[model samples]
Target: MTIEPRQLPAAQRTLPAMLQRQAAEFGQRPLLRVAGRSWSHADAAAAAAIRAGALAQCGVTRGDRVALMSGNRIEFVEAFLGAGWLGAVAVPVNTASMGPQLEYFLANSEARLLVIEADLLQRLHTADLARTALQTIWVIGEATGSWQPPEGIRLVPWPAGAEAIAPAAVQPGDPLAILYTSGTTGPAKGVVCPHAQYFWWGVNSAEVLGVGADDVLCTTLPLFHINALNTFSQAALTGAEVVFESRFSASGFWPSMRASGATVVYLLGAMVPILLAQPEGPGEREHRVRTGLGPGVPAAAGQAFFARTGVRLLEGYGSTETNFAIATAPDSPRGGVMGWLRPGFQARVADADDAELPAGEAGELLLRADEPYAFASGYFNMPEKTVEAWRNLWFHTGDRVLREADGAFRFVDRIKDAIRRRGENISSFEVEQVLLSHPAVAACAVYPVGSELAEDEVMAALVARDGSVIEPAELMRFCESRLPYFAVPRYVDLLDDLPRTENGKVQKYKLRERGVSAATWDRGPGAPRAKG
Candidate 1:
């Protein structure tokens, strides 16, 4: 059954309250299954209490930041809920974050403690711990290899609960998590998400998919992002079960869903095309998955996926900083456009001056929620950015979209330099920072190029130092260690100089128009090469 947000009490909108209420209502109903461990509805609150006690033993208190760096696992959920239960903010670091990125997130959020997987401890070798506020490190599993903690920092095995602690008096408007989103022209910004925002996320997403009790939702996405984290809220609110696969495997996706007995699946736009690329088999139609949320999916690819797998993929528009503000239902009139504006949300296609554009015109998509705390409070520790984004009392989406006369919103393109590749947001500024660090590169401009998969591919145009030669293979190896695998550039162009405006700023639009040329180096096959 759909969760009606209006009917929920103010207290019930917080994580601690939701866990307690669900425990009483659902009892032994399965709430989560991940990494071979299961948590029943009753176990949710119990585990959270135990974890909260453990956090308190480590000197964590209300409003303190606790960062979690791990993949899909029971311990990730434990740390996240524990922080929420204690009225502390949980900072989920992307598991793919390298040392530089990791240090930035920890420093920016002022996380007092970090719970990281044992395998990822080596990443700290590159991070400057002294720069951050972190004092304690709880390592899950055996810490292997020669890596050791720096002085003034405590490193120990994951601690056990000292005693069951009562939930902190957390309000719905309190910050629950600080999720970092890539910035266009600067470093990543931490989005301060209130507890009530997630409550509405669950309510609206469940309503869109018609989620009900007894249904099983499975997601192969990582636990760090809103897409996967929101699954927990969906289950708790509806008394449904959720399964978390450690990672996405095209060959193993169907088999895993069948193994988990998933009725509802979550997928990104790129995942649908990848799944359809695999060899057809009975496994596609053998699962019980009826529907899925596939945002950013091309209409053709979504239709093909549904035809082949018998699972209708719904398109929607949402970001880390917003709730599920727009979505398509099964009965939506059109297939290509992002569904109409969701309840409790106001949307507008406005120009640079914030004036609303007429229907059939393209402009920035601006949004504001009527419900209190339904949108992220603002970018954490970024007052100017918050003011810029929330100016005119509407959150500027930085996405160019067209509102059709029929009220459907069609995506145009991103107005920002942020690139979306394989469901991950890659910051051009961040990538350029890394590229500029290399001694061989005198100057560089990173931008997105269209991919056949209907997503963006990372590409870089570079001007080598006078005495240096830029080798594509060598540059790729350097990027692999510094940037996430997905953020590394796939194509590189050796340019004499980047096109520039009269003011000498890099004209990236010209670079984008130039696209792939004969002089460009392709790291992989099937990339279209331009004629000489």
Candidate 2:
């Protein structure tokens, strides 16, 4: 049988236009299913456009920045596309962030408007928006009993109907979204993606995966992340149905995939381990899932996962800045490696000097897209950082890797001090900052340690204040109170002084070399250390 991939209309080259075309072509077809109700393409598109019109009427004009804070609900999709329809950039705030983290994101993004879920609206009350230039706040779902908009902030109900409005004519290079890279560094850098960048993402992802109208795509990855926005958006371009869950649940994953009749699903590295840990059963292989996409599956785990689940696991390497840089073909020789570069994309391994290394040598991964739309425009409001990242006209991914003989790439390690545990990138700098807030923490260094279950585990070595007694349990509890659960150090080592260079920088490489083991950890001053 001859197979010809569907083509997007010429007029629908941009996101808003593509969404409009999809609405017209698949009016009666299922576009989104949430809770229990399924919204048709026409219904979803019309609602989004109406919301866009309302936002425009409320003074959110083209190029305005709008913050979207919501869980995985229909409202997120609507607000996202709605903002896109008005040529506004949607800043999808990570719902998991709390207090100062949340405050910093909203303020730093310089959002003019906030469309937030009712549950999260209360957070705005505590935020000092007056210091910033926020103008309005809109509520989704029902208003919380204790929630009220701050002074000068207007509350607009979600799903309210307004007249359809046309989107501003946007160039392909115009900013589409500002996705904050999960703090892998000091603070999350806002990766500025362009409309054409994402459009090309959807198109290339569809081409690589061969998604079609018959495919049902399920995504548990938050819509706020690029993995979902680009990888899952391919479903829309192919006229396929997309099933979204607000959050990932291991017990419900297989059952939901079966129920939705999903043929394609996105998997995070941590997700595979979680699923494998579940009770072995006949139902594991009883789903219609064809392929799974994402990164961080060790070769052994990838083989076992595929053998047990009967799903073809396709691993790909990319970031919020660039989508689908390297993708594993269905029949690639390397079992678990991210396959060769896709069409119009170039990958080179570079040393510390930014010179290309030999094919078999390990070094930093630098990517360049031959096509105009495949690369990011730049980092938002950070010209120096943007230029630094694109030095030598290549997008430098701070990830360490090695390219194999056949052009396939193998994951080596990350050059940056970022701990990727449970599929979440935790910045060591951020965690160290939280640790330093404690009175007992005199000095500290955070780094990634190998884990049997996760991609990596967070370990912290600390120096207590002179003449002060700080217990590991106490420090852990303090971190739990101040930071997200993922950022809390799994293991803590108390020391008189941390190994440092002559310049006073802690030698994290030595800590990683020594590694964290059950035998090496100090539970506390008196508590017994638990064996792993």
Candidate 3:
């Protein structure tokens, strides 16, 4: 049977309200499972209530910021749901974040508390807690014997369930989470996702995937990203079951699905090629999964994957600042496009000046939602950036695409200076900052180079300081501690000077055109030695 479409009232759009409604409707049906732990629909709401009470006992109140840095586990979900149930905003940090990025997220959001995995506590050693508003840290597991808390910061074990508290009287327009998206020319901006926006995320995604009560949804994507977090909402609204694996393993992916009896799965574009690269086996087609949301899978790879595995991966388009506004149905008219715009949203291909371009013209994609609070409220703590992105009463996607005569949006290229590698958006500016900090580096430029997979790879060009020689391998080792693993440059070129304009601004486009060269240093995958 299919889930019926219903227009939920504004009050029901919030997480607290949704949990109650879902519990009453689905009752004891399995709603969430992670690491062998299961929670039924009623248990989900019950868990959130007790978790909220625990947060309230810690002095958290409405509008407080609670930061969470963890992987796909039940505690992460509890903290997220608890924050919303307490009318507090949740800031989910990417688990790959290192000291510098972690410091920025806490400082920018002014989070009063942090819920982090015990292993990630060492990352805090490099972060200056004095610069942030963090007062307490709740570690999810036992810390190392020698580990010590920073001065003035209270350290405690994972919170226990307290007295069950009533759901907060939150409104639909209230902020639920502040998710940070990588910047093109600057630092990352926190997108203020509202309660209503997540409500729509569940409704739209469930409809696109045709999720039902009997369906079992599984996702290996990290919980910190919206792609995985939205899976919970999809199960709640559609009366489905969702399974979360600790992490994605190409070898173990099929086995996990078979064990869980997953009917629906989630995947990224890069994952498709990797999964296909594995030696063919019966395991590929041994699972019950019929379809998945593969947003960035290449047209050729998608067809090949389906031919081998019998699982059709649907392509879709969405960002941290927007909802699932564009999608391809099971019977979409064509391939190689981002799909048609979904209902409740409007799209336009516009030139640099925001003027709309006619059909078949390549331009920036602009979008706006018709439903109230259906899009992100704005960039938290960045008013000017928010205004710049939301100018002309539309959200400028900073992505260049062509609108075909058939109303299909084809991906062209990114207009912004960002790199997406391994399903993570990397900011070139952030990488350059780390490179410049090295004493041997005088000038640097970071840009994207096309990878064998249908995605971008981080590449850097640098000029050495006078009388100081820069070692490429050593520089990469330095970056390992400062930036995320995916953000580290795979290829590095040493140059006397970079291509620049009349005003001395580096011309990254020229470097991008240059691409990988013979003189570049290469870090082969699993290679014992670096190649140049």
Candidate 4:
């Protein structure tokens, strides 16, 4: 099927204009609700603009990067939108990240200002790093005590009742946000996304996902990720209400959905399994939610989830660099596959040499949207990395997949995570899927570990159902029955829990740091037996 790119609306050429337009269209409507306090569209816009004015007063200028460190709060939204209004890029630092990691991002982004939650500011009071480039450190919280700034840093009070200022004019290609990719592979690279890209992503997603004025979008995902930001923008563009929660709670998911009157929501791959593990109740299907969108829905769980919740789960494949490039329409075929290519986008499977692969062949997934607005600009401060990702005029997604005859694609595994052993290739994800199917397994992450015989060996780190013990020999036998000999795990480690990001993606790097050693291997039931 031939795909043609669509032009974005002129009003969406800049982030500030989009915010202004939303304010005008839905002035009296609730734009954001946090901790039971509602802020109308006008209220949010006014507050954001005021903060923008205050930021300008503190020497933050257009094109400057302002780093924000805060939990999911109303003030965070104001700071983010305010940065856009001032024509500055907002770098949302993950609160869950460590101090050294935060320092790296702040230094790399070269942020001129740091707008932090008061609690976070207090924690950084004694850090030894030079804040030379950081001109201002504004605190956003209630208790405003005298806090000394680090050397060469100016402390500014977060202004109150500051009037809205006129938003700075910005071009379509101007950087809006620098969302750093979750560095599961290595250090996080800032995905430089432009205003036009986000605006179009939100608009197109709303059109396809069917978010509207009456829809209440609830997000437990961190605003630092594209899923939450894009979903938030989709709601704003359509005049829909937004319900923000500080964090995701599996036990509270259903109750929150019902209480917020949410019609559309976002979920990560791990969230589904977490929610499914909670106690079953008649209230599961009682919410008004009509759609749940995002990736990581295991094939086995999809159908059962829909039948239980009465909400259509729309799973898609995309990364922080390319927002919502492919999605399953609401009426598309369900289970396993990540639907078809989204409108205005083209996808193909290519081999290691970048040659296109035949239908049903597993290879790297390459995508290209005919329009530039549909994709991210590049990585911030890393031209070579950007060039590497966009080689051959197509954005090379590191994910491996098989394209079906119907144009739908089934995600196989990440290229980096593929195990090479004795001239055989093993997809860790595929093996994990098979292992997760075992009733004894609650959650699992499969990765390649260094091997004496080959470049890498298959290793599985698992969290058992209700912390029950599963003998490794029994689990290996189950995998051997369902998987190829080369793909069976060579080593198994039982963990109390898997380390996850704020968005619930497994931090494979951390698991890798722990390494595949006998120390992690438990000799209890479900633990693997010693090989002969």
Query: Model-by-model lDDT, in order?
Result: 0.91, 0.77, 0.91, 0.75
Which candidate order results from sorting by lDDT in descending order? 3, 1, 2, 4
TM-score of 2: 0.92
Query: Mind sharing the TM-score for model 4?
Result: 0.78
Please write out the lDDT profile of model 2 over residues 72-165, one tens digit for every residue: 7777777788888889989988766655666677777888888887776655554676666678877787775666556786777764767888
Q: Residue by residue across 1-532, what tens digits does model 4's lDDT show? A: 3111134355456777777777877889877887667888777678778989877877789999999888777777888889988899999876544444556678788888887777666445434347336777877775355558666877765666466689888887889999876343345678888888888778767877788789899988777767777866886677888888877788998898898888888876656766787888988988889987857667667677887888778878777677677778877755678878877788889998889999899999999876665688888988988898899988998888998988889988767655554323455665776788898999999887765321456778999998477788788887754554556777788888899999999988788777867656532222232121
- The TM-score that candidate 3 achieves is 0.98
Q: Give a tens-digit lDDT track for model 3, residues 243-290.
A: 999988899999999999999999999999999989999998899998
Which prediction has more favorable TM-score, 2 or 4?
Answer: 2
Q: Local error of candidate 2 at 70, Å?
A: 1.2
- How high is each candidate's TM-score? 0.97, 0.92, 0.98, 0.78
Residue 380 of model 1, lDDT score: 92
**Candidate 1 overall Cα lDDT vs. reference?**
0.91
Off by over 4 Å in 4: 1-8, 122-127, 142-148, 417-532
**Candidate 2 positional error at 332, Å:** 1.3
Q: Model 1 TM-score?
A: 0.97
